[model samples]
Target: MNIQLLANVIGHEKGKKILINAFQNNKLSHSYILSGPKGIGKYLLAVEFSKTLLNNKSRQASPDLMVIQSTTENKKHSSININEIQELESFLRFTSANNSYRIGIVDGVEYMNYSAANALLKILEEPGNKTIIF
Candidate 1:
């Protein structure tokens, strides 16, 4: 897919071009961080990339894609905990059932606590054939 054309954008043409070029050249890294101001569609971009990579019509139904988000408790800001990271680790244990690439999207990664970050770091240290977008 021509992601640069398929995905809608508002500014950040340079960043979009970089991602599209990486996809076209088969040079995407094992892990990446999409950090910027809020309401800039980072989540949407991640989902689009995941769908394109997995060739899934519905991002939620894709077996090869996992989208992780931070949790909240008592109306207060909470963090992504170690349990979530462990779940991601378990998800990574299996290969893509559809022969497509396995992808993990960690939304709002800055909300991850120290332990969770450490767990994710361990996963990144030996990413195997999986791709993670933070």
Candidate 2:
């Protein structure tokens, strides 16, 4: 499928290029890690990609296509918590609505705690067609 992720002026030029390349490739990685300096739209790229992927399927029927912010209150999702990771795992485990993709985005992964990072690693070890990270 030809997907459009318009990330211009978002500061993730390299990510935009990489995503374009991934879309062009037949073997799109099931998991990705987009890391760079802050305010570079790394998380924005992930959200855009998820939305693009959702366009191919029905967006109305699925609630699990959630954007997870791994943060505590105070408007800070700069840390990935263990509970949040567990929720992500649960979302991944469930059968998809209409049997299609359901994306989970964990923003600000650099602040992940040890427990959450370990949990994420487990998911990474077990491959799934529906998951992507940024």
Candidate 3:
């Protein structure tokens, strides 16, 4: 395992160890929830984990990586809608470029509306092969 990937993150030692262990053992789950208070490096940890899983230097450029976040429309309230969840489902349906894992990260999932939450749950219940969502 490459400890350097998570070297920059402050604190969260147990979380880091768990992620590394899962990667090393090939025991990663289909979904994971990193719940805690705000500004505790949850997003940073998730990004690092995604990078490690994808084995790519750039998460934004990786075809196997999909990141979903809440969108604020017209400066009103922020939300994750059903459309975003559906997009994730569609993304997972495709084959990976190199027979690798397809990783999806949903940031601020608490902002998802009821319909979106249900949609995401449906995907979680029937996640595709080699597809993981966090």
Candidate 4:
């Protein structure tokens, strides 16, 4: 969890800033919707965030860290569908793995279908201390 690592991965001052803030504050949103055009570090930041969660080396990474990309694998340009949101509903419905916080990084949130968006809204409506960002 060095600044160099973040710089290399995120390649931006803002990412470093956000990481520093969250890490220092000891608080990070459970859910973060990384939205942006393709190849502009949204995915990079998401990946970095996942790394942080993996080692619990930063405030962002916790035992409940989970990343939901737009597609599973071998697929490109597919938006996040309704089933993904429903799956999140189920994931959120459960308790944390280690009684720690749960984080869901829903990339490309804008691409979610109407049903998915609504489902996400419902989940957001009752965050219950779960952090959500878009």
lDDT of 2: 0.67
Q: Which tens-of-lDDT digit does each residue in 2-108 have in candidate 2?
A: 34445333667776677777766755676778776766777767766666666633335346475666455444344667888888888888766756676777776
Q: Model 3 over residues 22-111: C-alpha lDDT tens digits? A: 878989888888889977989888888777767776536689888897665433444888999899999999999878989889988878
* Cα distance off (Å), candidate 4, residue 64: 2.8
**lDDT, residue 111, model 1:** 79
Candidate 3 has what TM-score?
0.89
Q: If scored against the real structure, what TM-score would every candidate get?
A: 0.85, 0.75, 0.89, 0.68
Ranking according to TM-score, highest score first? 3, 1, 2, 4
The number of the candidate with the highest TM-score is: 3
Better of 2 and 3 by lDDT: 3
**Pairs in clash, predicted candidate 2:** 71-77
Query: lDDT score, residue 32, model 1?
Result: 70
lDDT of 4 at 96: 66
Candidate 4, poorest ten consecutive residues by summed lDDT = 69-78
Model 1 vs. true fold: TM: 0.85
Worst 10 residues of 2 by lDDT: 1-10
Clashing pairs in 1: none
lDDT of 4 at 34: 51
